[model samples]
Target: MLATYPIAATEQNWISATLLGALRISLETLQEGNAPPEFDEALSEEYREDFLRGPKFKKAYDLFIAKCRPLTVDQRAQVLTALNEQNNFPGVFTSTTPCCSIKDAFPDVHSAANELFKHAFEKLSEWKTPGCEQTIRAKYHQLVDAHLSHGSCPFCGYEPLEAADPDLVDPDLDHYLAVSIYPFAGVNLRNLTVMGDKCNRSYKGAQDILLDEHSARVDCFDPYGAEQVKLSLEGTRILSGPGEGPAWVIHFDPDIKSRNWRRVFKLETRLRANVLERHYKKWIEHFVSYAQRHGFDITSTDGAIDAVARFKETCEFDSYPAIGRLKTCFFELVEAALNDPMTVDRMRNFLVESA
Candidate 1:
């Protein structure tokens, strides 16, 4: 669990402005007229500057921090109270009606509001010391394993009925942006979360749900006008900008399954071999062949072998993109085992080994 820092002076204003801007846009889109093109451009610029943490935003943040620190105790207390009030301001997409999931209720939004908050928060992760990574990851894992191993989704207070049985699932490094997209959030380490593979796979994706003109909707819950959280599972199965009702399992790929290798490889031995083999076979086959032709050990010393593995770890905040191409391969293997029915043994192997 990443410790959440309360929003300070500038961040509080940024979050409030971002949320208000998104609300304004969503309402404008719902009016009986065409949406202004400038709406998206303006929103994008705000997102780029505030949510993306660009240079201008950095300078502004420094000024805000400097001003906030010298506040008297009463002043600081007032800021803290305002931040807590913001929390109860009716979180966007809180509806749980059967015909309407949160996404279904909010249509016409460009992105998920919560995701914006998460991205903003993720910027803070860069300042954390080394122990923060392990601390957060371990806490996330503990919450997930408790539920998966015991038949629940602990973080959100959800549980799988025995009849549902989950067929297959694992603790996934989930961007809460996709699962429970909240506005004013920036998808930071604090907002990063864990969830069952089923929830991430079954419910979320890149589009807003269908909105009927007949049904009365709230501005905060509107998806089309809201800052949308684009869901990308398996690099496909995407819905965008007021399309589908919810995600349907439309595609599955075996090659991306890491647990497949687990069936044939132990944690230390076969896992590396299989990931390396997949990396060579899928991505760098041509380059590797050419390199071998020239007598260069590019596959070995070049770090291509562990590229995908490294990525898998870093996707959980372990490392950087410059290290290699490890994450893609590792993702594939994990996805493979997760989606494949026949790969139960492989999945089990992973659960035990990882545990």
Candidate 2:
């Protein structure tokens, strides 16, 4: 969930044009639905002839326009807060709060506003629509570019792309602000995210993965912003007796923010695979090679663990195989053992014996 580059000029222009077209369509749509009592009293004969002629719908419609206006920045913090407060939109599209639903959130919603949201939500998904996919939704190559750019699944850095072909499109454009929950923002360029095929379909299927901050996860790092953290080993590790396999325990520091981000994509368990383990193992291989050339045992307990930890601080912080994410678990495992010289000696000797 890395931060994304800004929308290209052509893309922004297309989106603005499409939204303007949507506004025109929204006016016509409001003509279909009958005026609710909330604004009926304010309208006279000619004005009453249409749905948006009254203030109820017009107010909401105008607000919708303001929101859809080209969002120059990605965060939309102030705008979204205003939306939840002034617009009465609580982002309840997926509210687990019993009996709450999209329809319920906007019961007295005006037709113009409804149509505006409806148009963007419905049209954005339709490739042939004017501002959706510049060329064709099926052929929109950005999804492909996004997949290749990340080198791995954007959602889970461990999953690498094997090939790219028209018939075999594997990556998916995930709606970071889920379409079901926040329909109004469905087509917003900022809301769309490039994701791994499995992360989009199987692992994160129909579930909300957004934290207070999107693109906040490291593997899953925000490509748009910068961050810093000193990672630590934070879970129980079991020392093995002879013949037992090494135990891997990885849990990031306790923070609601990290948990929410991990929960959204199931990073904890899903990331526990050989793909990431291989990366962790490579670090040792690298140090061994470095030791051989330098005529020193980088793996020796004398200063090995601390040296690795220091190196990790310099190289692994906020990178991938990204740290404080899925791949660093093994390093933590090693760090745990290094804390006990007996365990370190046992493991180091064991590695030599096994080799």
Candidate 3:
């Protein structure tokens, strides 16, 4: 990931709190050998009547209880414990260290628990508070606005993330722990974050953040509290083989978190297709025009080098920098190209032509 977003101050509202409370009560009641009907009665006695009236909540609760009925007493206890731990968003997400896998966490009942939570998450849209006006979905948008107000998508630092507006569509609320696997954290605010469509759907769709395909633990950045990871293109070079003009190597910090982030988002491949290949020539053209307008003589290699350095400085220090890391690295690449005597004339020619 290119940047980290600020953790939202908003706490889970009555909807989430009530659902979690009900789930816990249901799990505890089942572990004690209580039947499904008794679990229903228990929820009715605890939560408000209006909140429990919805068919959505009823269906979710009924399905969850039915799924739990097949589990052994030991399995039930394990599921309950996993749910509680996963719900503690702070404990689960405060660091880059990998947590236990769902299979290990819940042992024999992970599949059943995953389905139950998936159904429950789907039903969250229909669960409502008696006196509260905003739905949980609306609160999700508010969280998006809170974090996105700082800048672009925190995952890639490439696309812009817009706040929720009536006239505009809201960004995707990506489940950091994908619901298909870690459904225990489906509705946890810390697990949900706004991501660009490409990053969420195209790249990281349902990929597990905590474990690799072989189910090994992998270090992952905490979207809310992680420090920004840096990228360096100094080692990147234009390819020499056939079909290689836009093809070049991409480099990121050689840290486990960075490697995990790259693998999860396919960052290097994306950077090549989306940024370097697509924008390199356009950026160079724009730079030449910018230099000409600023009275730089692009005809001279020294002048081109100076302009490239100045552009890199501007990008490095700009407020609300767009693709700041990639831009800085790109300018450095241009500067290096300018310094190469073999490439300098070609670079100068392109700059003069672009001007």
Candidate 4:
């Protein structure tokens, strides 16, 4: 299984901000133009009322979707031209359009369109699914046995398969969520990730150790709410929160941490020495070599990126040095792309600098 990265909120920071501003401005403009100041009323009733489903509203929404949805690439260009002329969405035939103007023509279609846009935005917001330990364990072994007949870890980069087919992979245990959880506007494809046995089995039978709404009051770091997620060179420790302000610390797995530490440094000590020292060394060399390509001076970054990569390789959760920042960055960049699509280049540049 080949892993695809998440569409992060960090990627969309600027674009979301801009769209929010534009949305407010548009609403304000509409209100100012109203003879009796209907902006507040409209805003208040937007959720409760199905204005777009009204006869006139539905007509406009239907017209808009029919013209815009079935439009060929060339037709889409023309729709854009007309929308640009009115400073509103393309093909909004109604004068008092709700939320998105495109929905003003076909009110019934409005809800579906709104749902589509909402799902797309939420997907880009760094949403994650709970990792399943049992599923991961079974799948991890199957994947390893299939690709590594010699019972060796593929961390050495000499494995037969570099990726996996998501369709065949079992979701209950071996399935990853990010790459397929959200759908893009154009096509639908799922990215299943192939990981080593040790990494996938880090948590083993304890996969539900993450913070949730019920656990939020007791746990300081919320994986979703925090601004930063700090992980160690090994997959054992995690510091979560914003900036340098970490609020909580937790031990994911001491055994995994010890194994990962030894694996990372290729230490001569006795951690897994008899079981797979040679294999471990090969994997270590592969990653150490990979890190050098990114200008992440292994000696200078204080093994920062090394730690991050190792965490990713080991435990799927509580692994990732400065994970919160990376997640924030990724989410923001993705969000910006969804909102504007024009800022993708700038967001990419930002990622290069931040990394």
Rank order (by TM-score, best first):
3, 2, 1, 4
Among these predictions, the greatest lDDT belongs to 3
Q: What is the C-alpha lDDT of each candidate?
A: 0.34, 0.45, 0.67, 0.30
> How would you order the candidates by lDDT, starting with the best?
3, 2, 1, 4
Q: Which scores better on lDDT, 3 or 4?
A: 3
- Report the lDDT tens digits of candidate 2 across residue range 76-98: 33333323322221222222322
| lDDT computed for candidate 1 | 0.34
TM-score of each: 0.25, 0.54, 0.80, 0.18
Pitting candidate 3 against candidate 4, the one with the higher TM-score is: 3
lDDT of 2 at 140: 41
lDDT of 1 by residue, 54-166 (tens): 54333333333333344444543443333233333224324332222323333222133343444444443233223344233343344444433434332222323132223
Q: Candidate 4, 136: how far from true, in Å? A: 27
Model 2 ranges off by over 4 Å: 1-101, 104-150, 161-170, 209-232, 236-241, 274-295, 298-320, 323-342
Q: Candidate 2 has which clashing residue pairs, if any?
A: 1-220, 2-221, 2-223, 3-222, 3-223, 3-224, 217-220, 218-221, 319-322
- What would the per-residue lDDT of candidate 4 be over residues 1-355, giving only the tens digit for each residue? 0111222312322212322233344333333442222222322242213233234433432333443454444544433332232222211212233212233343433354344333323332232223423232233434444543333222221223333344443222211212122111101111122334443444222221122224221111111121222322222111222343112222222333223322332322211242223232343344345555655554433343343344334322211222322333323323333234464444333323344
